[model samples]
Each structure stands twice: as structure tokens, then as C-alpha cells.
Target: MRNTLNQRRSTRQHFRLLEQLLVATILLQLLNKPAVPVLSTLLQILLLAWL
Candidate 1:
């Protein structure tokens, strides 16, 4: 139905936003300090949970 399609589109947009956020976080961390795997890992876990 149209509602289901809308939901799917919204979910996809959320995922895209999250992916951009994750990339930005990683880039910021790398620029601000040495590469920290823990933060990135935690973010990944959080994103997975969100999905």
C-alpha cells in the first residue's frame, strides 16, 4: 500500500542519515585525535540497534 511505501522510504532516509553521521563521527575523531576503534565500534553497534 502507499503507507507501506512511505514507511520504507522514511526508513531508507533514516539509514542514509545515520550512515552520514557515522562517517562524520569517524572523520571528526580521526581529525581530533588518533584513530580510536572503540568509539567507531560503539557507533556501529548503536546504528545496528537503530536499524
Candidate 2:
């Protein structure tokens, strides 16, 4: 039981980090090219799928 709990915690942390990275990437892309709506929409879709 304890091992399972630890594994779950680790997985949660990994997903949290991934979420932050994705958000940062989205922000950077938007900042670098505000005119690229297609890429932005794709990233938003990817983020939504993850959630």
C-alpha cells in the first residue's frame, strides 16, 4: 500500500511538471509569434486532451 501511494505521488508530480512545461511552451510560442493561430490552437487542443 505504501509503495502504491508513493508511486501515485510521483506520477502526480510528473504530470504537474509536464503541465507547467506545456503552459510555458504555449506562452513562449504566443509571445514569439502572435500571428500563428494554427499552432496556438493545436497547443490548446493538446493541453485540453491532457486535462
Instruction: Find the 10 residues in a row with the least total lDDT in model 1.
Output: 33-42
TM-score of each: 0.65, 0.62
In candidate 1, what are the lDDT values of residues 1-51, reduced to their tens digit? 999999999889888978886887778786885555676776788777876
Off by over 4 Å in 1: 33-51
Residue range 6-46, candidate 2, lDDT tens digits: 98997798688667766766787768866557756766775
Q: Which pairs of residues collide in candidate 1?
A: none
Question: Which residue runs does candidate 2 get wrong by more than 4 Å?
Answer: 33-51
Could you tally the backbone clashes for each prediction?
A: 0, 0
Native-to-model Cα distance after best TM-score fit, residue 42 in candidate 1, in Å? 11
C-alpha positional error of residue 20 in candidate 2 after TM-score superposition, expressed in Å: 0.2
